[model samples]
Target chain A: MTHTQQQNEHLWQLMFEKVAGVISTKDLHYLEAQLREDESMQEAFHAIQISFGHEDLERLKEDEDWIDILSVIKTRPRTTHQHRFGKYTVAAVLAGLLVSSAGLYFLTNRKTTPPLAAVTAGESPQAVVLQLADSKTVLLSDKTTNIRLGDVQLHNAADQLTFSSPDNFSVYGGQHTLIVPVAKSYRVTLSDGTAVWLNADTRLQFPFSFNGSSREITLLSGEAFIEVAPDAGQPFIVHTPNSTVQVLGTAFNINAYNPKQVRLSLVSGSVKMNTHGAAVVVKPGMEAVYTPPEGLYTQSFDEKTVLSWKAGKHFFDKASLSDICLILYRHMGIKAVIDSSLRRHDIHFNGMVDKHKPIQEFMDDVKNMTGVDYYFDAQGILHFR
Target chain B: MKRKVEQHNDKQLLRRLRTGDPNALNDAYRQYRVWLLVVATTYLTDEAEAKTLVEDFFIECWDKNLFKDVRVPLRTFLFKTLTERCKKQGIQINMYP
Candidate 1:
């Protein structure tokens, strides 16, 4: 290379490094000095930046597809094995049956038939049901004004169920379970003022009032976003199937959809996650995933994607066809049966599904994107071929 | 004026990207990967190395969570980062002017 070419390359290297935030202070000083003295160097830098944005470059034809890039990234070796669903693939299939059976158990074991007032006309089969401490199950509807069980009174309005106790004392100490079935979500305010937004197919068990030294609740299954009321004197503790999250006052999300794994994403404040006697402190923007036998792993997460379900949307990135079908079943109450050939091929989907929209819209999008046709059987089971 | 609108849209895309939208990432990759590859190939003669450099730029940006801190226009930032990666490979930029 000629002397002028060498000089220009050096200047270019400095500018690139500056943008990358790796240039040394001395090199930056040198580059600044050269820019001050040489107007041509400034012009060259401008040209380089502009040229990078040009669409019609010589090698532009060699560009690869986004899927190719995703494949490369996915196949690359990682320092840790953090595949959330790899270990549970077999268990997940079995767990699918278990989830349905469990749902059946809840349905058949209702201690009392829902009262006429609580059962609105055209009530959904998968309506939100709240089991009082006395074991009486009341199917929740927006028209239900008030429910009194012992000393705890619940005010039901819209999708929110707020609990109010006549006194702070422990008059109603038995546990109450709120079961939100498929294709619906509900919010509940605990007697202690903490509010929890339960996602579809979730069951949360807590006492009518927190009477002990610590506030404790159990997430029976599925996902929830919780904002714990701050009380320095009393710590809040949530027990999932595989992990325990202890927080004094904070907002966070917990996903225990898979029986073997519990994913906790802290949005604000701090939380301590405990699994099999091992503990880790998770800060805001960090997610601690606890999968037993494999142990717990902490990593940064995107808040918007993780918390998107609260907004009535679920985002999937390269999620397997089976997993997508499972989510569709859980969130839409629609059974999806993929063709055997397509299932063997292991097709994946990348997009968002809005819970508020009809399942037909999602099916249309899937058909348009993947050229996979679908039809609803007489039984309303979706079959994709 | 059109360029300004495009820049504004890119900024919105980046914001969605920070929120962990995979669709936004795919959109960005489709929109800029070719230009980025061209920039990388301009500095390095070897096409394979250029491809690796461009891929690494995207990988590192995502894996290291670098895009969260990006303050410049997405296109400019992507170009500069790709060029920087090429420089680290000890390739000199081939100045056209």
Candidate 2:
């Protein structure tokens, strides 16, 4: 091929990549620059665009206009129909109440509950513990059997607890707290059919059976990915330290490890987050962060990075040394102490730590990459120098 | 004759638009939205962002009272303004030959 022909082929390749939504930013800029200066290149790009225009038009037609353009320009109420949530009547009603009340229900439950001393760090339990409403605590492991509490039966199979309640109209049978200690994770299915995957060093409290207009659960601490069962009559509400997330029927991950902020990433469907007096609705692929003083705000998030813990891996993107140590302590139950000399310097890491792999593999990788040496002291604490 | 008739209608629409007539804005959107959207998507390669650009173009035209000083035909003016906006976003389309 001639040099010009080869350049044309390269330009066409870039155009195709652009249309496929996989063009790197640098190549896109180069292609745009060529299209700007060369009329023939402009014609070629337009031809490529027109070839896909019909399908693009069809897709655009099928998309519901979430914002009414004309009404917004006219300074009128841009009441676009929320067709996605139309089937959930109670969700629609609660959404309306959320707009009008500015989170009155959330504010009423703002009193902070004291942290459970039993699950505190440095004294972390080795196995999962379930505290029943009768103040009876049961240690859970792989060989545990079923436990009955009132009309509900906790079926223990391996690392998961599935609740089977025969009656649906039972009154509030009292709250049960599930504590997952460091170096472990557990899954629990609430009586309302909501499945919650508890992460390490996590605490979750839920009732035996939901009998009211809303199914309420408290994420006392740590992280959890919850898949809520669709119940139009009773909206599922999750209470964290700094905020409350109201879900009609959705799956989302809530990270409340930092006591100052609660990060809730919505996987599917919509959720309303209420913090202090501010309320924001979070859509799928978006995260709502609530911190005291800063309040609540929503931003786009990467799904693979935010929800990687469910797959038994923790991904770090330019995380500080101190942060990595905290994560190690949280996931591996090994107290990581950085030497004072190493702590003064700004050292960051980019890697993944697998829960299934031995901690030494990760330590070796870190040491090889950054020349940071680590050893377990006499007290079983990890020390980095 | 058909071209002249369109030019006359365009003048009337421009007059109403400059006077802040909502019907004129609605008529303009109904008449030109699809063509403008096609032009925008061709450059942006993102359907959502393209729709926003088109919508924002019309809204900004109204907000800035840009129709009052239109020396060219309304269609040409709209096309030229939208092309400039797309150019600002780093994609350039060939104007009328």
Candidate 3:
């Protein structure tokens, strides 16, 4: 590595060391110096501060925005994220069944590759779909799909969807919704240069270009991490079913899957979560939970463990058997049937598992770790004993 | 009014420094050495280079009266001046925190 790159890497190591309480006074002085002036260094330091220790992990679970920062750092370019799926990789036949009821027709891709076949109407539905302002739907099935509207260009390649617009690009109206299917994850960059990573079963509706005093987007369902581009004049607002997060140059995550509560985690900078008439400002390393009756409440969190899904990895922190089964069912397309008599639902497991691995391997690992046995029955349903 | 007070204090400090008073430089160093070191290290990322740059800044301050007629606060002046130097030296300086 070059000298500057080596120095940056060393600074990262020193930051971890300082957080671990092993750094010397000299290193601490240097670290403090770097943190004050370098924005990226400060970001790295905050990430380590909220992502390392057990208590910190709990804090991370509370303020889960660090996952977005890690994803941006580890995976650059933000497009075409390829996953090495195991031999038992299924194209989510469950999604086909779910979409079958929607009665939506599919259009074949003109530039379909032979290696990965185009999503047929009833066979394998496109995992990602874009709905335009004109009420026309576009299934992202081609390896690289480019859609141009006005000054903005939306490019969809593999796992990421990026948007690029000119400096003076602005829109007075028009909106689009990006939908991520079950067992799939996608990333997108907005016209304002804000980066958003959408989790499975999520629908995000955003304007073609922000023109009002405030930039606003609505999340119909599921979870998303948003890195708001710095624009002090116009604040970015994410409106969920239960709450709205008002952001000014910040990185945060919103989980709106549970109907009873909407979870908001701030990684860096600040955000205001408003539900009903009540509102609360969330700082870095903090989480704001908005439950109907209780209103809004804030607490510390563990960012790394909470946001691990952004990296296509699972970090279970005493996750209950039912919860793990549900996650597997949602993300892995694995139908888990835990025997009520044999399974202990209260028993929680703590470990990391690569989602790219086969369901059998995941079950085997879980069995080895929790001393629980699981097997696939004749009907392809996972049975736990 | 806040900006005026800041500028007034900066003018006083520079006036004292130009009089060749050792304590004036010491006072200035005491006030900004840590901050200056941080800004320098962020650019150089090396202790030796950081020290050299800071020393060069001070040496130039003594010779050229760098902040003699500055209207802004000394902190702002120092940061703006040093950041420009950093850019000329080909170091990437992040504008936002």
Q: Please, what is the whole-model Cα lDDT of each candidate in the order they appear?
A: 0.67, 0.68, 0.62
Model 2, residue pairs in steric clash: none
lDDT string, candidate 1, A1-385, tens digits: 1235435545665655454333568879998888777664565455344334433333243333223556644665532333322221111111111000000011111112342223333223556877656554655654333544445666677788897776555544678788887788899999789999999888899987787899999998889999999998889999998888999899999999896989999999999999997999999999999988898899999999999988888888887767878888777777788877654445567888998888788878877877778888898888888
- Rank ordering of all candidates by lDDT, starting from the highest: 2, 1, 3
lDDT per residue as tens, model 3, A143-192: 45454444666667777888766657653247788777667888888878
Fnat across every predicted model, in order: 0.04, 0.02, 0.00
* Candidate 3 regions with alpha-carbon error over 4 angstroms: A1-126, A149-152, A164-173, A340-343, B1-97
Candidate 2 TM-score, true structure as reference: 0.54
Model 2 error, position A241 (Å): 1.3
> By DockQ, is 2 or 3 better?
2
Candidate 1, lDDT over the whole model: 0.67
Considering the two chains of model 1, state its CAPRI-style docking category: incorrect
Ranking by TM-score: 2, 1, 3
Q: Which predicted model would earn the best lDDT?
A: 2
Could you tell me the interface RMSD of model 3? 26.4
Which ten contiguous residues of candidate 3 chain A have the minimum total lDDT? A96-105
Error of 2 at A357 (Å): 0.9
Error at A268, model 1, angstroms: 0.5
